[model samples]
Target chain A: MAIPFSYSLRNLWTRRLTTVLTASGMALVVFVFAATLMLAEGLRKTLVETGSYDNVVVIRKSANSEVQSGVDRAQASIIESQPEVARGTDGRLLLAKELVVLINIPKRESNKPANVVIRGISPASLLLRPQVRLSEGRMPRPGSAEVIAGKSIARRFKGGGIGETLRFGMRDWTVVGIFDAGTTGFSSEIWGDVDQLMQAFRRPAYSSVSFKLQDVTAFDQFKKRVEGDPRLTVEAKRETRYYEDQSEAMAKFLRIMGITLTVIFSLGAVIGAMITMYAAVANRVVEIGTLRALGFQKMSILAAFVMESLLLGLLGGVAGLSGASFMQLITISTMNWQTFSELAFSFTLTLDILWKSLLFSVGMGFVGGVLPAFRAARMNIVEALRSS
Target chain B: MGMGNGKPPIVEIAHLSKSYRRGSQTIPVLEDITFDIADGEFLALMGPSGSGKSTLLNLIAGIDKADEGTIRVGGVDITSLSERELAAWRAANVGFIFQFYNLMPVLTAFENVELPLLLTGLSRNERREHVELALQLVGLSDRVDHYPAQLSGGQQQRVAIARAVVSDPAILVADEPTGDLDRVSAGEILQLMDRLVREFDKTIIMVTHDPRAAEKARIIRHLEKGILTDSDGQPASPVAGS
Candidate 1:
């Protein structure tokens, strides 16, 4: 028969000081492990949400990102003429021949130069990406040296707020509007008129051609046509898939670094749990013997100790998750490896992360408690009672 | 010897032997011990230190195994039972009282008394009723929620007694149940044990060094150097103090 659950809980309470100390060690390790996973999840979420499934991007076949791809005017026109491209209410094709480039800008707080994405767009750009809404100020006038800064850029970079002027590409540009791209990578970019930006930067061709599909299901056929066209050296990818690829390398690095650090820290926490449980067993030899004499089996004693350790782990898991949850409130910036530009995002905590963390904490408790529990179970009842 | 009520002995032990090995030295603790305890009998074992009184008590309690022998309690051959079966048998048949009481410090008196019942299939309310009845019998109903540390030494021993009788086991083995208590508390504890036998018909086997404690038992047997003897150090009779 199993021992009462209250027995294990009360024993932990009786030794509250050691219980707290050991649980705190486990809590710290869990915090680090969970925080790392949250950070990676945030980055992946921001990038993945930046694109829409219905939109397709046409880039040079050998290029990995928009900034590295080039599409000439002829190729852009050919892509826009496809029968599968959607038409706007005004009978114009819903397509944007965009130029993507990176420019160094001083951060508002640190005044340190950081690479920021500068996307030059046609009139249909904002229409195609409905997530980017003009939150404040007016849209930039076409054919003028005026730019709209994303909310993150407006708040974090110098000369990025509305009406501020930034000098770049041997010309001055005015920040005319602030756009909000909720939790997406576009929040870290600046947009302006395509022709004006191309002229200012002396670019020879458009970086990419993006258009909404007339029917989302036709994406495969459209992709096949675009990839097989002999006159074009371009590849077609759904915008969502393209952005997902962008987050892969950086997210993988963060997860690896997080796991390595968590593994090392968890070892120390496990050892701490081991020592605490061992001491508990040592202190309760007589009590264990008394229980045995009262008809409790050896397995019951083992289960009691293990149950106590699991309680300890659960305590740590809760504390650690509480600490990690606060990270979502603070937005942090890091370099996006694929585009070599600054991307700002907040830590994101999902149900998946929550369950995984709790399971991990309980697992630590099991690993730490098993051996000590065995020692308690294997003790001879006579010897244990005699020791007291 | 004739049992007072003409009932057969509740416990029958024959040729029981036990020894310990300490780094290649074999020290015998009990040899060829044969004994019988009547139903509802109060028996006490007294001896000098290392005289095997405690060992003999442990063997009867089923906490220790003999190297060779047969012990039949309640008509079942306990010596032939496996370790697991013996544990189950002990749980169903024997209760224990220690000198120090040995109550779980973390548990209140009520919870401590409720421990053995946790192994049974008794419902929670049923268990509570039994525990409350036991506490009332020991006159500690008001102290049911008090921890061991919160109670006096004598009160703790009373709680221990209540726990021993809570399950109504056939046998109760006490090892120096009053060794750690004062004379007043010890007398109270011995009186309680006597009451259990007189009123509840529990067969008790106790090991003690105090002659006063032995005087409380109806039957007193002494052991010397791993052998049972009389108060005069003569070989023990098949049954003493009948």
Candidate 2:
């Protein structure tokens, strides 16, 4: 004979205070778990979605990121003249020499200084990234001391939005525009005319040169041709792969942190569930005895209690995931380890992350409830019946 | 009345001896007891504290194992049955009532009554019908939806009785059923037990310290120390003192 599900449900409901308290504690653990995964997901999305697979970036030999690489104008010109480089509508190579540097800027509320990446890009750079769009104002003119800030940066730094002025190295630059890069890494950078920025910062060489290849298949040939020439000691890689490699160390660090914290938090939640289930069994001794006397198998009693705990865990998982989804409303700024500059990212709650969090919650419930359920099943009917 | 055909007794016990091990010594509880209960016989077991009356009832109810014995209940050798088999047999043939009316506090009267039926092969609708009939028999039809906490002690005991009889087991074993109730409640409980035994024709074996409660049974057996003595209107040697 089967025990009705309503019996377990009603029993849980009868102890509403304990049920809710245990569930909420589990919810807090799940929330932290989901948030950590979202942080990792946001980091991955920022790097993976920022560049195209067909586009190739040329940098100085042995350099990993644009901030560490420097290519002179002559070398940039030589790379742009390659036969495998794609041509724009103007019948010229689709190549851009860009500058990447970091400057310390004051935060909006606390006035505490944070390092922010300032990118100097040519007009061709805008053509290279069609996803970039100005959300607030017009793009700055070529020769003017004006800059456009990424949407995320605009929210984090003082004098970052349109119409504000920011001082950088004794020169005041006007914030003329605000742009969005569709939630990618570019959303954390500041853009201006390459030549003007290079003059202001006294940088003679560009950080890196980016260009679209004639055919993705020609990438290997292009890399071979560029590296084979000792006259130009350079490295060429697909921009997407480049950004992927750049994010690997940080992604690994985030994954470790997420898993470690989730384990710790899940331990606390499991302990909470154990305490609640133990109390439930203790209080329902007579009820269990009646069940035994009524001929319910010990396995059934164990299964029923474990199922109740699982239901509670599932409730907590749903709540935590729902709360994490709302975190997209906030914008966070943290220093990018590779560039030592603040990179703005938002919380992302993907379906995969939500499902994983739910599975984790259920596991916690099962692990925590088993001992108590065993104790309940092993109770002596006579002793249990005698219990007040 | 139809005993001329020599049908097997519903309950049979032979040389049943039960003891508990206390440290290094074996303390005997029921020493070489023998008894038989015919089908539909309303028997009561009366004894003082430490008289092994409840222990005998537990052994017959399949809740405990005897140290040495053969116990046949409803024509099945219960003493030889495994723990799992005994539980199934008990579910099908034996009903139990405790002193405190141990109804699940979270369940309503109807759900509590429906519990034993869950161990049966009956469908939900059939279970509902049986539960309804049982509750009706106990006069708790109006209190089916009320929790145990909301009912009086007597009503709770009635619900317990309904639960015990819901599965329609062949025999019922009650231990101090009215021990926790007041005089009026106890009287009502005794009357209900009498109706079950007379109308339902159930083989009832009850343990009680109250002689008034025992008076409702057709035959009352007394236990002193660990020995059983017949007290069914017949002269018997005084136990232990003789």
Candidate 3:
């Protein structure tokens, strides 16, 4: 027959100091574990939300990012002339042959220089991304030196406020507006007229050409046609697929970092739990013997000890998760590893992360408790009773 | 053979031997011991320190396996049973009382008494009733909620006794039940044990070093240097003709 759960519970309560200390160790490890996963999840969410599925991006075949790709004006025109490209309300092609470049901007608080993306857009560029909206002031005028700063850049970068002037490519540009891109990577960029930027930077080739599809389902045919054309040296990709690829390297790095930190920290926590459990077994040898004589099987004793450790782990898990949930209130920035541009996002906690962290803590507890529990269960009843 | 009530004995041991190995030395603790105790008999095993009396008691209670022998308690050969079966059999038939009370310090007196009943398939209410009755029998009904540390030494032993008999097992084995108690508490514990024999008709096998404690038993068997002896200190094989 199994021992009552109350037995294990009270035993833990009886040693409250050790219980708290061990649980606190586990809590710290779980906190780091959960926070790292949240960081990775937030990064992935920001990049993924930056793109719309119906839009396609055409870049140089071997280029990994827009900053590295170049599409000449002729190629941009050919892509824009495709029959599958959508038309705007003004009967103009719903496409933007954009130029992307990076410049060092000093952070407002630290004055530390960080790489920020400078995107020069056509008039249709803002229309293609419906998620972006002017939260303050007005949009940048076409073919002018005026620029619009994303909300993140406006808040974090020096000379990024409305009406402020920023010097790049030997010309002063005015920040006319601040646009919020709602958790998307676009919020980390500065947008201006493509022709003006191209003249200032002396660039002859557009970095990439983006176009909305008239029919989303015809994307496969359009991609095959673009890739097969002898005149085109570009590859076409759905915007969503492009952004998802952008998130892959950064997400993988975050996961590896989280696993490494959690492993190192959890080793210490598990050892702490092991010490606590071994002490409990040593102190309760006589009690175990008495239980054995009273008819509790070895399995029952093993289960009781393991249950106690699992409870300890559950306590830590809940505490760590609560600590991590509050991290959603914090917005932090880090360099996007793939694009080398500063991106801002908050820690995002999902139901999946919650359950996985809890399961991880409980697994740590099991590893810590099993050996000591075996020692307790495998004790000789005669020798144990005689210990007293 | 039928010393107590002329009925069949509840516990029978034959050719029982046990030893311990210490760095290649085989130290015999119990050797070829044979004995029997009739139903409702209160038997005490008395000896000096290191005389192996407790080992014999453990064997009879099915808490320890014999090296080369058979032990039949309540007509079932316990030595023939596997470890799992022995555990179930012990739960169903054998109760144990320890010298230091061995009460779980974190549990209340009522909870301590309720432990053995948890192994049974009794419902919660049924277990509570059984626990209350056992506490009432031990005169600890007023202190049922008190932890072991809150109770006196004598009260703790009484609680231990209630725990032992709560399941109504066929045999109760106590090792020096009063060895850790004061004289007055020891006297009280002995009187309670004697009452269990006359009133509850329990078959008890107790191992103690106290002569006064042995005097309370219906029959006292002596053990010296791993061998059973009569009162006159001679090697005795009285019951099983071994």
Index of the highest-TM-score prediction: 1
Cα lDDT tens digits, model 3, A198-256, are: 99999999999998999999899999999999999999999999998998999899999
Task: Please write out the lDDT profile of model 2 over residues A1-388, one tens digit for every residue.
Answer: 6567787788789888988888888888888888878887787778878888888999999998899999998888888789888888998678888999889899898999998888999777877888888899889899999999998878878999889988895699999999989877898889988889999999999999999888889999999989898778789989999888877778778878989988998899999999998988888888787787778888888988898788878877888888888987876767778878777777888899989999988888888889999999888876777685
Structural similarity of chain A in candidate 3, as TM-score? 0.98
TM-score of chain A of each: 0.99, 0.93, 0.98
Candidate 2 chain B, which ten residues in sequence have the lowest lDDT sum? Answer: B233-242
Candidate 2 lDDT, tens digit per residue, B1-242? Answer: 12211333577788889888889998898888876776777778887898899889888988788899888887788899877787788888888888989888878899889888888888889989999999999998999899999999999999999888888898899999999999999999999999997788777889998888989987788888788887842433322112
How close is every model to the real structure, measured as TM-score? Answer: 0.99, 0.93, 0.96
Worst 10 residues of 3 chain A by lDDT: A137-146
Model 3 CA deviation exceeding 4 Å by range:
B232-237, B240-242
How good is the docking of model 1, by CAPRI class? high
Best by DockQ: 3
* Model 1 pairs whose backbones collide: none
DockQ for every model comes to 0.82, 0.60, 0.83
Residue A186 Cα positional deviation in candidate 2, in Å, after optimal superposition: 1.6
lDDT by residue (tens digit), candidate 1, B1-242: 45645567898888899999999999999989988888889989998999999999988888899999888898999888888888888888999999899999988999999988887889999999999999999999999999999999999999999899888899999999999999999999999999999999889999998889999998788888899986677897666544
Best by lDDT: 1
For model 1, what is the C-alpha lDDT against the true structure? Answer: 0.92
